[model samples]
Target chain A: MTSSTSRAPVAAEGTRARLIDAALDLFTHCGFAGTSLQMIADQLHVTKAAVYHHFKTRDEILAAVIRPAVEDVKNLIAEASAQRTPTARAERMLTGWVDLALRHRALIGLLQTDPAVKPHLKEEQNASILLDQPRDLLASHLSGPGRQVCAQVALLGIVGAASTPELRELDDETLRDLLLDVGRKILGLRRPRSS
Target chain B: MTSSTSRAPVAAEGTRARLIDAALDLFTHCGFAGTSLQMIADQLHVTKAAVYHHFKTRDEILAAVIRPAVEDVKNLIAEASAQRTPTARAERMLTGWVDLALRHRALIGLLQTDPAVKPHLKEEQNASILLDQPRDLLASHLSGPGRQVCAQVALLGIVGAASTPELRELDDETLRDLLLDVGRKILGLRRPRSS
Candidate 1:
């Protein structure tokens, strides 16, 4: 009887995670605005009520869907920030960001470029803080009067191009190599050694 | 009476053009899926029926809205394809593309990164042709086995970064210079002379 009770909550948690996963896939392909709770339910072969039981609204589902990625980015920023030198910090940001972008390619694209998703992202606390932290990290090592804009371009360009459909056909290793190479060039950092 | 009759068609044309413009604005900010006929009509202070008189569906309005941009891109491709040398052709493409991206910054963002809009863009006749021509042009000039991926990164990265909110505050001239500088770097071209 005790084991049955414990398994019940675990089963519910599993279903909730499955729903969030299905919603993320739908949101990636159908878009945040285009996806409906009914569609999410259908994707998981459940009723709309089942979806509502977990997420009260589409926005709630969206928040849950993006929460892990946002946390990952914040964690990335934290680690990169801990580096001693500006160059090391920037490199940490660069390599870490490229991996994050690759790992969450579609979700990153949807979050960055989707108009409907932008406002929701902005609602996350300290969105500006997240933006400024990386800009400052990158700007410290980058040269020229246009360093601010250049930093933004390097960061945005790497993730943006990584998520593009044309590059989708390229394997992750190859894509990672190309992105790191171009990202280093954009930031005026030394190329990765052949060794 | 003759003058009034002659002017009626012109007035209709003016309203039609205004509706398309307003729809484009709505689509850029609200997204293709989030936008509705009523929103477009309300933007122009017209009734839904008036919008229906011109467009049977939101898709029709979207087609009308994006037609000009697609035609402009096609024209740019034609002009670039005419250059005798690959270097000149790539240079023309790079310059023309940056200008085009800057001109239609938000619209390009909506068209490229929005998942809901991808299928619609693919439905355009010869979408693959438009993609291949630029890849071939860029491949010819870019050195390395990853030329294809590099070419796409340069093109997509420029437009994608140009459309980002961070770079939105940078003036067009500044954005253009930054994009051209980075584009040339990615493509392995010589830097422009300061003088």
Candidate 2:
């Protein structure tokens, strides 16, 4: 994973978020192929040219969803990275990921299934902005090579949990608590040995 | 919630299994939209009309996929119900479900996200295939309602756990063990009742 070494992280601010929020509404309403640049332009109340000024193509907008999922993950990890203890940092990172997954369920589903949108995700490289952020965040709090692999797998498990239909029906509070419970189980962060 | 009160249990077993297996292969390969009834017929080495004779439309075949994900859950519960001990039954059901999910990852994915497939799936009633199955399976074992609900959620959490991309990469033995560990933690099955 390139981590932060390659791209200076893009903050989820301004035109970037406008493009994302617009894309989210359209993609979820219409299947990805059914959505078009013209629709996005109209969604933003901007002309096609203005939409292009921000994102050159539909793929650009598709790539933008990864920004929020990745950024939230990065923020979680970034906060985790600053913690003094490895265990505390991991617990925070794991719990935060579950919370984010539950909160941003639809967006995560878009990024997961739409084949058109997945490649732009730089999960292995810094490009997998969605995955790498949490990965790097969790890696910082761990020591062994195996732990990195576990954290990477655990991150995907968290995404899968929150994104799946079974998890989707539960109310936010229920979902949040279940995910936190699952996260502790995944990390095997035993209570007391826990956060 | 009606556990197929119909005495026949699975109607037309041979034909239904053939249709579902063929659909699973084709749908996973080409996705729901990309496939056609003719392709399913061709794969089965049967005429298209014969395919229709079994399944009325492409939606019917998509509907068939739902059966396995649900039926497996039902079967797991049936077995658990047979066991007299509560902890033993809960263990049997959770462990069995993890195996089933790993064995059928592609179908599970299709049941999950393939937009073309999900709508026709009738997953809401079938959600009981999951929601109610474990509730019954653990009923014999758990004394309290909260613990029973937790047991059911943990079983789905096992379903959730098996759905991960990284876990998908691991061999079944390793994946099963990892989920068992999580199951123990989530259901409070492990000694010491840690996280």
Candidate 3:
């Protein structure tokens, strides 16, 4: 599969991007149920037909909006799995996951919190598998008894921390440092010796 | 303000309690938007009018469902605030908060994740105040610069960890211990000297 960077060329510009942007803002604030295609079009000062030409339905718009982030996750899992050791894989996955989550904090928050967005997002073919792939991969690298639970909780902590409104004020770097610090501790993984 | 235990006698049993219980289950599983008063009544094998008599609207039913937990938070903050030292207060608030969170994991998850329940829950008088009180209190007890952010993230970690599907399999005692363990580490609070 192509990396997010490579796929960015196809869906990274024009009215498609604008619709995605507007949809995200509305979805984040008003929620999926609260937002309508007309609202998205109105926000962009475009006709409904203009918006409809690119995406036929609200779910299609949502699919477009989340595509890049999901692709990045797919790429992260692929890269991490390619690592030779479980430790290396876990470290890579943790850092990569944190980076992705921070970069798209609002989208991540919506996905986690908004019920309307959730069912539609899940309907995407392979969405569940894609979502669980990294989690399962991360669980494999977690050591000791109850590592599965530990891995899951550790991930929950990282994702939850990143999505919090209170931490929104912290710059990406500061937030990343704190999240990685706590996340590593939760996962029982020490800092890489080389770092 | 009445404690959760003291107020239990008021709305603890009978139709009110049953309605709240059924509403919470439907809300947790089907979400607030997906669940209707009819469905709630159906779940309890009662007519919609029976449910409506107890709760005039879905929002009112939601209010009842969340009231006990919200009250418990209020009591937790009040109790924690009575403590003299920052460490003591933070420890008390942390433990009590975790205990309450574990006890009502599904409701807490719905409150945190479901958007439909949020606005209705927020409409209750003092809802925002009740929600922020514990957070503000927790921040006060947390020391050093950046404590607000730290306190917020720590609470998120605890709530998020407690609500995790993976952690659901573990017994309540084990979950509480693990949550407290990570919660303390996140808040920068050293374990209480006695414990």
lDDT of 3 by residue, A1-195 (tens): 211122133432566787899999999999898999999878877677777777889999988889888788878989999999887888888888889878777888787657577657554434335546656666666654456545555565567667767667788888887677766766667888775
Q: Write the per-residue lDDT of candidate 1 for residues B35-84, one digit (tens) a residue.
A: 99999878877777777888889888878877877787889889988988
User: Clash pairs of candidate 2?
Assistant: A70-A130, A121-A128, A122-A127, A122-A128, A123-A128, B86-B141
Write model 2 residue lDDT over B78-168, tens digit each, in one string: 8877876777787777677768877777776665545555446564534444566665564345554235435554555565446545445
**Candidate 1 stretches greater than 4 Å from native:** A1-62, A109-122, A125-132, A192-195, B1-61, B109-122, B125-136, B191-195
Q: Summarize candidate 1's per-residue lDDT along A1-195 as a digit string, tens digits.
A: 111122234465676888888988898888788999999878877777767778889989888877877888889889988998888888888888889889878777666545567656545543445567776676668777577766766776676667767668888998898888877877788864641
When summed lDDT is taken over every stretch of 10 residues in candidate 1 chain B, the lowest stretch is B1-10
Q: Count the backbone clashes (under 3 Å) in each candidate.
A: 0, 6, 0
User: Higher DockQ: candidate 1 or 3?
Assistant: 1
- Chain A vs. true chain A, TM-score per model, equals 0.81, 0.68, 0.83
> Considering lDDT, where higher is better, how would the candidates rank from best to worst?
1, 3, 2
Would you list the C-alpha lDDT of every candidate in the order shown?
0.74, 0.63, 0.72
* B76: Cα error in model 2, Å: 2.5
Q: What would the TM-score be for candidate 3 when compared with the true structure? A: 0.78
Residue lDDT tens for model 2, A1-195? 211111233333454677678888788778677788889767766566656666777777776765666667667777887888877777778778878877787886765545444435454324234565566565555554344444654666566556666445566777676656655655667454433
lDDT of 3 by residue, B63-131 (tens): 788878877887898899999987788888888988987877888778665756655656443433554
Better of 1 and 2 by TM-score: 1
Candidate with the greatest DockQ versus the true structure: 1
Deviation (Å) of B27 in candidate 3: 3.5
